[model samples]
Target: MSLVNQQIQLVSRPMGEPTHDNFKLVEVPVPELQDGQVLVKHLWLSLDPYMRGRMNDGKSYAQPQPLDEVMIGGTAGEVVASKHPDYAPGDPVVGMGGWQLYSVVDGGQRGMMRKVDTTHVPLSHYLGAVGMPGVTAWVGLNHIIAPKAGETMVISAATGAVGSAFGALAKARGCRAVGIAGGPEKCAYAVNELGFDACIDYKAHPDLKSLSKALKDACPDGVDGYFENVGGMIMDAVMLRMNAFGRIAVCGMIAGYNGQPLPMANPALILVSRLKVQGFIVSEHMELWPAALKELGTLVGTGKLRPRESIAEGLAAAPEAFFGLLKGRNFGKQLVKLA
Candidate 1:
């Protein structure tokens, strides 16, 4: 049977915030499978903040998402056709399959595709809780912050993919997990659903002074550790509440992902608090993935780690979903359901 693949390609690099005009949908005929190849029908596509940085034409942690190409993304899917001995039709897998309906995967390709066990952990989880976002939270908290029992840890963008996992993991480890989110609903969900100790609605507290006051109230003992997903003012507030010898993991700067340049409020806080702040890309730390994935997978499978998602219905909704993600419109993990 002949298969046609539908894909969304990066047609233009966005100046600041991305829009529908930056992408183009294209259809192509799937080629015949080679001896060591398989065709996967993508079921879910992960839309994340990191892709925003990839959309820009500049130097950063990774290479820019090239123009006129399939936009970078993670996908979970089922093998529809296989010529390789190891994979059979209907095998569930997850990989960096980009924004497409089907992905051509090579058996010889080591990291791009991996068969995932969905009996305990759902296949969609390979893109979120049991996937990169989960690993990111684990590495940042375990390696960088290293929060101990009874310590207070703050997370910004607290209801999104990385922060939600971070909050739940922190709580699991016996730390006081406090969150900073955009709206009251997200704030309530962070505390009520994610079990965060407290959640501050940044929208209600718009200015630096107001947010700092809220943070001080939330972290009465001061912030012993911080999982930074949003930078700018939220970060500034957290810094002010940092305890002596505090630790910080700079996971992302979502607040400044757009073209805006947000300067740090207090550069001297690092020295004053004797803070340890480290920035990392989870992909670089491949050694820790096995351990992290094991723990995260178990937590997700057992219902200990409850991660939420904002799923878009089709491949065409990718751009709009991603746009909302950048603006903190997404409730948890933003995903596109391709099938």
Candidate 2:
């Protein structure tokens, strides 16, 4: 067993917004692995916007990250030592390994970890499209939003991991996919690179009313499905233009993640349109992941699904990168690469 572990912890609960002081990077001794436990050296760490909710001290679908505890996250790493027969040295796997260079994981806590064939696809891809983000998109689209062929679909945070995956899946299913991103570059990437039917730049079009009009114009058929990643005004705008019997999959609320309080939506519109909105955490839908992963992997391997990742070079840059993600500064799947 190792004597030291370098890790990041939550120093203070953020109020309006998180600052650098909210996180503290500290080195402590690694705990010894017990029977049926394995030690993993993390290679790739995923940074998703939903993590913001876990920082707050409140009851939600999942437990909040406790103050002064290691920040929780998903990571891809190789087992270095194992008392668990299921995992062994050099086996690449992914699970809830928190924000650390190394972790001692109990066998029971490991869910999705399996030896991977990195020769076929990059190991990091397991943390993105073929992993949580992909499953999030799949379940939201298929089970929740349920977009029909030739219907109009729109997604907020369109250049991000989950949002982009949603847009691509919508397009693949014969729906017209429209994306709302932060900037022109991201908009361009959404349409040109990601093959979205159209894209709206939220930064360029600051007026929610105008944005709503543009979205309505883009989808003359009316928005049949909305994959909501960024909430707040975007939700308001989309709700105004939603067609009858529209479905909304509430995947994230990145717009309010940086400490802003979300305004109440107009309930009248929901009543009038009979909109079906369902919020879900990926952890709750773990039962569907194996099937979702197989489908997503097929799409990626066959070139039907494309994932764009915004990678930060070192573990030290994760905090800044995460802050950028909350501000819509990242272009794709935000990840911190560990050496």
Candidate 3:
């Protein structure tokens, strides 16, 4: 007899926006481990904005998650059984285990799985602040933007996993962090909880002119750096506020995922503005994660980076939770608690 595992699979590619009908929940028997494999029982599943791009069968940085397969996702769980020498039962590890209750990893594959320390930081934080999202912030701020002290840095989706981490990381470098979120509550959290200098509610400003003015008021000295997550009008608005020679790290342009992408506005002329813009995929730069993870873990352990989480109760709730994530319905890191 084998373990029966519950998992979510993407049944169809989304046309405009994804719906519940696009996903299928099914149970399958966990496969027997090969000589070099280990079995992991997932405890948490991470749902991110990037997953949206993976759902479409289009040209992108990474391949489509693959139809009829387990919906791809990051997971933090314990190795329940192991045939590999490096991993033993009870080892806490993190990997791309998809949306499943169990995962079998070929321990021979490097970077496929990593054993993490949950003594200081909770295992769940590894999915958000202390994990990929945290590293994204570090890479963008340190590697690309590299803002100087007293400079102002603005980020869209400011209360999200990446945005929240970006604020604390920028502040550590003595940069004034400003965030633009959808509503007043999110703005308040960005300022008060995330330690951002100020936050602008994009919802309050319906048009591009209003959003730009709000950014102008929030960042009086002009924006020295921008960590772009939500693009489109947000990018246009932020572009108008960018100072000459400012740096922009385009991590996600989710504003264009479901439909036709938004065209850049006139203010985004890098030649005249002399702005340095770079779009990056963090997975491609694995060499930086060691240093980035160290700093993020310290921030959380020291109570400096208090990452908030919104956890859906079970595996079945992942799809709905993910939809909420794309719609800006979840605050902080969106996750599904599996076990």
Candidate 4:
């Protein structure tokens, strides 16, 4: 079997917003599988906001994506060849296949690669709702923001992969899930399609006072929990409306990801409201994945969690698609289809 692997590598680090110059796409021969390795032909590559953080060389929870190496990403694909006893060719699998059309993974690694059943759920959902993003939403909501029924839970980036999944999980726990998205279209989808109680178009309310008023109107009982995605003004607005003993799960700060300053407008509110704000990296909680995946997969299989995808056609489109995701240009989960 002869196969050439197409891959994208990070050639440079971005000072501000990433430019195309930072990435270089090239081709290489797919390495022959050894004793315990498996060859995976990536079908769907996930583009997420966390990847932006990995692009920077600065120290973080996870190691920075090395220069000249495959750009880091999650991929859902099918095994093309396997020397591992646990895997076989044609098995649907999920792993960190990176920005490439193919991957050679060591099946012996504890959590590096695993086979998946795509009968009830689509293979792509494993990269979004039933994969990392959905689990992120679950971990933050359950472990951090632990909301009670009848409490108001708000999430920014409402129509995004994590927020959409969070909306479903929050609703399942009987909390009033409110959403904050960038446009009228996203807001409409968040409310009508994703089943949020109300969704505020943050674009319409661009400033603190305006956004705070909108949040107040949508959440009449005050915000008992917040799943933060975008930071700065939206967070400031939420801070003003947070109830005593409120919880905040700080997920992504996309607003400041491009080197923008993201100072909270009111630090005193934290003390006054006595809010429990926690920032988490979901990878650290590997033990909870089975439970999270079980709930998320069930949600998708049962048609309760309807995840939308804005798919880019091929491996080359990943860069542009990721840029669109950072700019709020894509709807729902952003994925790249290699085949």
lDDT of 2 by residue, 67-97 (tens): 8888999999899989998888998888878
lDDT, candidates in the order shown:
0.91, 0.85, 0.93, 0.94
Question: Worst lDDT window (10 residues) for model 3?
Answer: 260-269
- What candidate 4 gets wrong by more than 4 Å, as runs, is none
TM-score of each: 0.98, 0.95, 0.98, 0.99
Candidate 3, pairs of clashing residues: none
Per-residue alpha-carbon lDDT of model 3 for 85-172, expressed as tens digits? 9999999999999999999999989999999999999999999999999999999999999889999999999999999899999999
The TM-score of candidate 2 is 0.95
lDDT per residue as tens, model 4, 54-100: 98888788899899999999999999899999999999999999999
True-vs-predicted CA distance for residue 175, candidate 3, Å: 0.6
> For each candidate, C-alpha RMSD in Å?
1.0, 1.6, 1.0, 0.8
TM-score of 3: 0.98
Candidate 1, residue 298: Cα displacement in angstroms equals: 1.6
Clash pairs (backbone) in predicted model 1:
none
Sorting all predicted structures by lDDT, with the top scorer first, yields: 4, 3, 1, 2
User: Comparing 2 and 3 by TM-score, which wins?
Assistant: 3
lDDT by residue (220-308, candidate 1, tens digit) is 99999999888898899899999999999998998889879989989899999999999989999999999988888888887877888
Ranked by TM-score from best down, the candidates are 4, 3, 1, 2
The clash count of every prediction, one per candidate, is 0, 0, 0, 0
Which residue window of length 10 is worst by lDDT in model 4? 56-65
